[model samples]
Target: MNGKKFVESHFHKYLTEHLNAEIALNTIQNFDIAMNWIRSTFFYVRAVRNPSSKYELQPRMDKDLIDRKIEEMCLRQIKELQKNGLVILNGMNLQTTVYGKLMSKYYLSFETMKLFRQIKGSETYLETINTIVKCKEFSDFVIRANEKGILNQLNGSPIRFPIRGRIRSNEDKISCLIQAVFGNLTLPTPALIQESIKIIRIGDRLSKCLLEYLRLRQSNDSKFRCYKALLNALTIVKCFHAKLWENSEFASKQIRKIGAVHSSLLVNAGKTTIKSISETDARTIESILNLSAPFGNELLLNIMITYPTYLLDISLKSENVIQVHLKQLNEEYIYIGSHTVLIVGDSLNNLLLYEENV
Candidate 1:
C-alpha cells in the first residue's frame, strides 16, 4: 500500500485493538464511556508530551505528528532501557509504565507488560507522561547506540525476523535486540550519511525519525512528498529552537522571540514546498489569508509550520504603535513591520523583526 495507507492501517488496527481491550479489561458497562475515556486519555497524554508546540516553536499538532512523536519517544525510552540492560519490564514507576502500556500489545519484555496496571489510577500520570515524551535523555542514548553499532547488531539476530542487524560486540544482548528492529543496516547514501550526522547532532526523536524516513523511501507520490517536506521543515525549525535554547536562557524563556527567529528560518523551507501544492489547496490557504493576516501566504505557512496552533493578531490601535499577539504565551509580543523599523536582535543575530512607522 501507499505511505498514507500504511500509516493509517496500522494506526487504525492499533487503536481498535486498544479500545476494545480497555472495555473488556475494565468491565465498563458502557462502550461509549470506555471509548470516551480512552480518547481523553490519549489527548491528555498528547497535550503534555508535545508542549513544545505551546512554547518556543510550534510543534506539528496533526494527529500523524503527535502519533509519530509519542511513538518514537516511547521507543527511544525502550532502547535506553535495553542498552542499559535494565529489565525493560522491571520499572514500576507511573511514568515508565506508560511506556509499558503503550507497548504492551507489542512484543516487549514480560516485566514491562506487568507494569501497565500501575497507570490505572496514578496521580502523576500526566506529569510522568510529560517527562517521558519531552525528556532529552534518549538523544544521548541514540548517539551512543550509533557509535557502538548497537542498532545494527540487533537487526541481524536469528531470533528477530524481517528486521535485520549487525554488531560491534556481543557485550550487550539487549543492545543487539534494539538493532533488530531496524533490519539490516544498508550503507547509507552519501546524502543520507550527511543527513544522519546532522540529525544525530540535533538529538531529538523527531529528527531521528526524519532521517530514518528519508533513508527508507521508495514512494513517488506527491502527497507523500509533501508530507515528507513538512517533516523536513519541522526538523529544521525544531533543531533551530534546540540549538538556541541550549546556548541562551532568553531563547528558552522568550517564546515569541525564538518564534520570530524560526519564522524567518521557515520562510525558506516554506518557499520550496509552496511549489508542490495543488491549486485547490493553494486557493484554500489564500482564502484564509485574505482575512486580516499580516504576512503573505508563504510567510503565513512558515508561521503555521513554525507554530501550529498559535494565534497571531495585528493591532494598530495607536498610530505610533503596532501590537502582534502571539496568543499561546500571553506575556510575549514581537515587533516587526515596514521599512527601516528599529530591530532588537539576538546574540545569534536572529533579528526580532519589529517595525513601526517609517
Candidate 2:
C-alpha cells in the first residue's frame, strides 16, 4: 500500500490459498528437493484436470514442462541456500553443511535461517527479540486494520516488557504475542489467542536454533563472548516453556494448573515454584488455591512432567572456546537462541563460559 505495491495481506492471502487449498495447486512454494516433493506437487497439479482415472495419464501430460519447473525450483532454492552458506558444493555434488543439516533436520526455512545467520552472539535482549520476530516464520503474522487498536491497548497495560513506540508491523504483533504467551496475558480475540498458541508452540524450537547458532559461532571464533548472550537465550527458552517471564512477580504460575489468577494466590500463600510446592504439604497448597485435597500434588506432578527434559552438555573446546553438544546422558534436563529454535531431543538449555584474562 505504501508504494510496496502488494500489501502484506496480499501475500498472506496468496500463501493461504496455496497452503490451505481444497484442490491440487502448483502455486505453493519451497520445494523439498531431495524428498521429490516438487515432483509430486507438479504431478498433482497436472492430474487435477483428469481425476476420473487414477492411474491413467492426463490429457496434457507434458512431462517436459513438469520436469523443467521442478528443475528450476530445485536449482533456485539450492542456489539461494548455498549462497547463504546453508548449502555447500562438496566436490561435484551439492550437499548440506552442518548449518544446512540442522536447518533441514529441524524443519527450518532457508529464509529464516538466513536471517538467523546475522546474529553475532553479542546482541542485547531486545536486539535478539527484534531479529527473531522478523524471521520468515513470523512473516505470516499480519497486522489487521482493526487489531492495531487492541494491540495498542495491551501495550499500554502492564505487559512484562513494555515495548517502545506504537504498535505496528507483523514483527511488533509477534513481539507482543510472544510476551502475551510468557505473561499469560488475557487476550481479547481468538486471532490473538491462536497467534499466541502458534508462537508458544515454536518458542522452544526457536530457542534451540539460537543456541545451535551460538554453539557454531563459539566453535569457529575463539574470542567470542557467549556467556551473557547464552544465558539470556537460555532464560528466554525457560520463559517460553514455563509460560512466565523470568522476572515476573507471579512466578507461581510456573506450577501447572496455577494460571494467571491463581498464580497470585500461590505467591500470596508463599508457594512459588515446584520447589516451593514440594516443600509444602498438599493440603496447604489446596487450602491456599481453594482446590480440593490432593489436587495440589497432582498439579505439581503435572508441572514435573509437562515438559520433557533434554540433556545438554557444554564442554570447553579450548581455553577461550566452548563447544555445545546435545549428548545422550543418563542424567536429566537442559535449554536456546535461533530462527528455527536450534533444538535437540533433550538438548539445548545449557552453557559454560571460560576466559583467559591473564
Per lDDT, the best of the predicted structures is 2
Model 1 lDDT per residue over 39-134, tens place: 465443544455354322246566555545554444444344444232233242212222333333333233332332122211232222222223
Cα RMSD (angstroms) for every candidate in the order listed: 22.1, 10.6
* Model 1, position 322: C-alpha lDDT score: 63
Give the alpha carbon lDDT tens digit for every residue of 182-259 in model 2: 766789999889888888777668876876777776676666656556656766767776677877767777554667
- Model 2 per-residue lDDT at 138: 70
lDDT of 2 at 265: 85
lDDT of each: 0.34, 0.61
TM-score of each: 0.19, 0.65
